[model samples]
Target: MRAVVYDGPFKVSVKQVQQPKIQHPNDVIVKVTSTAICGSDLHMYEGRTAATPGIVFGHENMGVIQEVGAGVSKLKVGDRVVMPFNVGCGHCQNCEEQKSAFCTEVNPGFAGGAYGYVAMGPYMGGQAQFLRVPFADFNALKLPPGREHESDFVLLADIFPTGWHGVSLSGFQPGESIVVFGGGPVGLMAAYSAVLRGASEVYVVDRIKERLDKAKSIGAIPINFDDGDAVEQIIRRRKGKEVDRAVDAVGYQAVEKGGNTEKPNAVLESLVRVVRPTGGVGIPGLYVPSDPGAPDEAAKKGHLMFPFGKFFEKGLTMGTGQCNVKKYNRYLRDMIISGRAKPSFVVSHEIKLDEAPVAYEKFDKRVEGYTKVVIHPND
Candidate 1:
């Protein structure tokens, strides 16, 4: 089997690795067809988190089940399925409440678990020829039929619903205006969700023209932060009407609004400044408790010097965390199947497993047209 293994800071490689097997009674071994490189993966790739060398580098994944364990009854060896980024046990109290991301049984000491992510769990990632899924019946959502909708269906594993979840967290109302920082895949999807759910206007802020162009393709107003203050651009576009909601999809790796220097809290401060008084903000971005490789000492310990006073003064509300991908994957899948959503539009590159190392390099640098990259492991 071939897998993308982390080598060190700013490095990854496609190398031969042992194939996965059923480890638990509820486990299933999947022949991975599609897997995505998430923005959070960059955190580990850059050595910002605790992801050590040799960890596999994928999480958002979908494929056909090749083998099922004894206890898995709802699915067979041939069912097409997609596993959420988060790992969960079906019987946990948190799982019962539809908060699968925080399932108490997967990673004992932590509140959440995700495949191949740093400090998430021990599970190997799906960026390989095969992947082992635990609690298969609970974690793997069966696809409707064949693999015809592969690219569209794959987004259900993470970013698509995560974008919707961000809007939900921000208490988005129909016909309201919203702004999203960072025109990366998640940000583009967030704008798409807002557009689909009836937001009157959607604004996406980023310096990358390719990303901003994707936002435009989805009918979002692109705010070129490099042109000027992003908040000012938003205000100018809306004729000084403040946005009702905001999303910070660019996390700790965020740079200053229009500059290249690292500013971990830049997006948060900008959101606080731009959103209307009493508006809501959602942070689907990744923020670590401690980032030893951060550019500054304060950010190294995950201490953000944000404008808390402004946020508090305006009475703005905030919601932040990893998306509970299971809670919405099923519904999002149906949406794609019904032709109501086509998340594959954001997929800028689809490469074979061997090309993952180069994809990582280009994507990490925000190269033109590399909005999102998906790896076809079995290609």
Candidate 2:
């Protein structure tokens, strides 16, 4: 079994590794069909996020059940399913509250567990021939007929649900205006989700032309931050006032022009500058407590020089966290199946498992035209 193994900073290799087996009564062994690279994995690949060497490195996955543990009755052999990025125990207190992202029983100190990557727990990544999914009945989302043609449905494993989470966190109401920072897959999804939820206006800000163009094609107003000051453009668009809501889809390790490295104050600061007082923000971007390469270690404390005074003055609120994937996936699946929303439009490239190394390099560099890369493990 060849799996994408993390070697070190800026390194990965598809190496033959021992196959996984069901280790828990509630686990299910899946023969992975498709897996996608996530921006979160770049953190580990760059060694900015704390990830161990030799660990598997993919999270977004869709596959067929090869075997199921005794405790898993809801799923059986041969069922096609999409595995949520986050693993949860169905009966936990957090799960009961519909906060499956913070399930208490999986990783103890951590709220939840995810396949592969840093600080996420011991679950192996699914970018391999097979994966052992724990609490399968609760976490594996079963797909309906012909769902594979709807390759976009697999995006629900993370990006689609996450994009929806960004809006849900923003506390949006119909007709409110939103400005989404970053034009990555999640960011694009966030804008699309906002439109689907009836936002009066949605602004997608990104330095990349291709990404911004895609956002435009989807009926979103594209703001090219690289063309000029993003804040200025957004503030002007909102009638010289702040937007009703803002979303940060750019997480840690955000880059800037002129080759100057700095902490990600752009998204947070823009949220403060553009979101009107009394409005809220939804931040689904990956913020880490520490990144070795970040320009300011002080900023790594999860404390940024945020506009606290303005935030308080404007009576603003903010929501931040991982997407409780299971909570939104079922609904998103229906939306995709019904043709109401197509999240797969974000996938700019499709590659084989062996091509993952090259694709990852291009994406990590934030290269032009690399939005989302879907890796077919079976290929």
Candidate 3:
């Protein structure tokens, strides 16, 4: 079998690797059909994380069950399914409470686990011909059989639900206005989710015109931070009114306007500035405890000079963490099946497994039209 293997900083390759098997009685083997390269994957690809060579690089995955273990009962061979990036053991306290993202049993000593991500877990990623799914009954979301929603269904494995989780964390209410920082796939989905939830107004902030255009296409008002201060831009558009909520999707890799400089807390600071007093902010963006590529010693150690004084003065609320994917994937899946959602709109390219390396390069560079790349491993 072939899988996308991380070689080093700014490097990845699709190479032949050992295929995964049913290692546990509760496991199942899946023949991967579709997988996606997430922005978080860039963290590892750029050597910011502890990811080493030969790490299979994928987490957003969906496919057909090729074989089921003896312990699997509800699912069987030929079941179409999508597994959340989070690898939960299903019986842990967190998993029992539907917070599968922080399952204590999967990645011991860590609060959460994710497939193919550094420090997440030991599970090999699904960006290959086949993948091993542990606790199949709890980890895999059974999808309606067929290829009809292939593009959209695969998104349910990660970004779609993650975006929704960001909005939910903000305690958003219908008719409230929100601004989402970053216009990548997850950010776009956050804006889309806001629209579907009946937000009075949706604002997306990004420097890229392509991404801003996509946000506009989805009824979100796009704010190009490169043009000016992002908070000022949003406030001007709202006629001096701050938004009810904000979401930070850019995370620690955020760059300042008109510069290549990395500011680990740029998005978080902007969220504090643009959200109305007493309003809330949701952060689904990936922030790490350490970054080998950070620009400063403080950031290298995961410390940011947060605007806590302003945050406290404004009486704002904040929610931050990995998305408990299982908490929202099922409902979001039904939204896709009913045509209420089409996350595939953000998918700008669909390439074969062999093309993954190139896709990763372009996507990492934020090249125009590389908004999202979905890999069809078995195509």
- Candidate No. with top lDDT: 3
Candidate with the greatest TM-score versus the true structure: 3
Ranking by lDDT: 3, 1, 2
Worst 10 residues of 2 by lDDT: 254-263
Q: What range of 10 consecutive residues in model 1 has the weakest lDDT sum?
A: 256-265
Model 1 misplacement above 4 A? 257-259
Candidate number with the higher lDDT (1 or 2): 1
Per-residue lDDT of candidate 3, residues 215-292 (tens digit):
999999999988999899888878999999999988999999875988888998898999999999999998889888
User: What TM-score quantifies how close candidate 1 is to the native fold?
Assistant: 0.98
Candidate 2: tens digits of C-alpha lDDT, residues 5-85: 999989999999989988889999998888899988888898876787899988998888999998898999999999889
Superposed Cα RMSD, model 2: 1.4
Model 1, residue 367: what's the lDDT?
Answer: 79
Cα deviation of 283 in candidate 2 (Å)? Answer: 0.8
Runs of candidate 2 exceeding 4 Å displacement: 257-260
Q: Whole-model lDDT, candidate 1?
A: 0.90
Winner by lDDT between candidate 3 and candidate 1:
3
Give a tens-digit lDDT track for model 1, residues 1-379.
9999999999999999888988889999999999999998898898877778889878999999999999999999889999999999988899999889898889989988888888888899999999999999999999976778898888888999899888888989999999999888899899999999999999999999898889998899998988988998788877987999999888888887555788788898899989999999999988888988788888888898989889889999999888999889888888888999999999999999989999999999887578899899998
Where does the lowest 10-residue lDDT sum fall in candidate 3?
257-266
- Model 3 TM-score (2 dp): 0.99
